[model samples]
Target: MEVIAERRYQVRGMADLVLRIGKPEPFPDGRNFLCPYEIDGPLTQRRSHFGGVDAVQALLNAVGAATIDLELCEEVVQGLLSLHGQSGELGLPDPLALTRLRSAGTIG
Candidate 1:
């Protein structure tokens, strides 16, 4: 999964992205695809849109235009970047594994 931060040239702030991508391709609008993902801008809640600059941007855009919170968006971006960096690392536990461990009281 390739996540890119969506920039609102006219506005500010960002949000999280969860995507269901297929494969890389091109579109009629000149947007390239690594997978099929979309988000528009900040709103009261997350809304789905397409043709974002990247994952972060898609997520931020998905958030809609009604609500734009810079701190929250930046925080989410950092968290996602951290997770992205941890991906495929040998010692790191996956989210499900961490959840299972916490549930079993093996980790807190």
Candidate 2:
């Protein structure tokens, strides 16, 4: 199908899509059809979503082997992004700075 569709299904926790095959459409004219084979993204992305592959992996895990909706994926992505720092906006707040502050016990 389309990338948006695939992404949507992934975030919504819908059906799983696995195998994807391109087959010729049985039309008057010979044309190929992209068939998305459904499987299980959730199970597949479990190990992969540990470090930095959370968005894609979560989508896959949510809708294993199923086409997902990009919009939904965007929403999920935003949620994930919000979990990083106090503001939840990309990048981790200087771990070294935090370490120094923690070691000092207090900031002036």
Candidate 3:
């Protein structure tokens, strides 16, 4: 596996890393599939954290998605929030809680 794409930037004192890892075709046949990208941020380290990776993971878990599709990221977060405690609420129990079901490890 190799990093097909990498994007990094800094915001204030914080830094972020987003990577897309996947296998490549032996030749440039143009039949390869698009690999999912990963999201990484320093929000988890802050006292108040939410959105970013936290939001992405919740959606992956909810949909059991193998790839991180950003298009559905917002929708996934909304859906998770709509399942508050199974009491038919409109928000999560913690409501935008900062947590991660899967850490941003190396992906291929």
Candidate 4:
């Protein structure tokens, strides 16, 4: 799969993690679909420690275990949703509302 975008994040000043977004591929049923993004680096190499759990829980546990900042994780998740056109399904406040809040120093 072709990588459409990639971002590298420094993990706790210890290691670098690269998150790669792949180009969407069309399914045999003629539906456009994006594959799960690829993650590489030291953190991923330890994922076996999180194996056997449900995917969502595994991810949450892994994030906690890595001690990544919560805000940074939120931004990454929101960016992925926005990139994949699923942002509207997030049930969060409108972007404009968030902007206003930020401008008002309500959120950082």
Candidate 5:
């Protein structure tokens, strides 16, 4: 697997970690497949609490994603929220609530 792209965003006081990961040569000789890793953070402890191996494992499990694809990060975030019982609506939900989901480690 490989990381083709990565992106992080700040959304109205939220902790979102959007990334793209995937295998190589899936799309073509010069292309590959990628998946998303949308996590939440105030990232509190960059290396201890939220930036360790466990965190990566949790993210992998959260989205059932093997690779990182920022394109699908939003969907992964929603799924994580839903798993945590925080995602209220399908396409739309409360923005603050989403942030809370990340902080709570429900997405992890």
Candidate 6:
């Protein structure tokens, strides 16, 4: 599992939190199916069956839970989204625009 992207941030003066995205690989079941992208971190070390978008959402949730800072979480998520080459295929919103909107008090 090659790491495709990674983000690192401190959590409330604790150890640095690391999140990594692994390149999607074929399932071990040999059913000619591709597995979900791997989401790896110090806290999130388990594999998920979710697809592209849900995988990102799961990562965001984990980030939120760890940091409890919405803006920081958004920044990390945006970094991951930007580093991942296939992010456009995930059908997610523009993270930059989302950040701007949040800063402008357009969304809560």
Ranking by lDDT: 4, 6, 5, 1, 3, 2
User: Which candidate leads in TM-score?
Assistant: 4
Clashes of 6: 0
Relative to the true structure, how large is the alpha-carbon lDDT of every model?
A: 0.35, 0.31, 0.31, 0.42, 0.36, 0.42
TM-score, structure 4 vs. true:
0.39
| Distance from true location, Cα of 103 in model 5, Å | 45
Q: How high is each candidate's TM-score?
A: 0.19, 0.18, 0.27, 0.39, 0.24, 0.35
* Candidate 4 lDDT (Cα, 0 to 1): 0.42
Evaluated at residue 73, the lDDT of candidate 4 is: 52
RMSD of candidates 1 onward, in order: 14.6, 16.4, 15.5, 13.4, 13.6, 10.9
Candidate 4, number of clashes: 0
Runs off by more than 4 Å, candidate 4:
45-108
Worst 10 residues of 1 by lDDT: 86-95
Ranking by TM-score: 4, 6, 3, 5, 1, 2
Instruction: Sum up the clashes in candidate 5.
Output: 12
What is the number of residue pairs that collide in model 2?
Answer: 33
lDDT of 5: 0.36
**Candidate 1 global CA lDDT score:** 0.35
2 against 4, candidate with superior TM-score: 4
Tens-place lDDT digits, model 6, residues 10-97: 4332344454445544345544333223333333444433222344454444333333332334334544322234431232334466
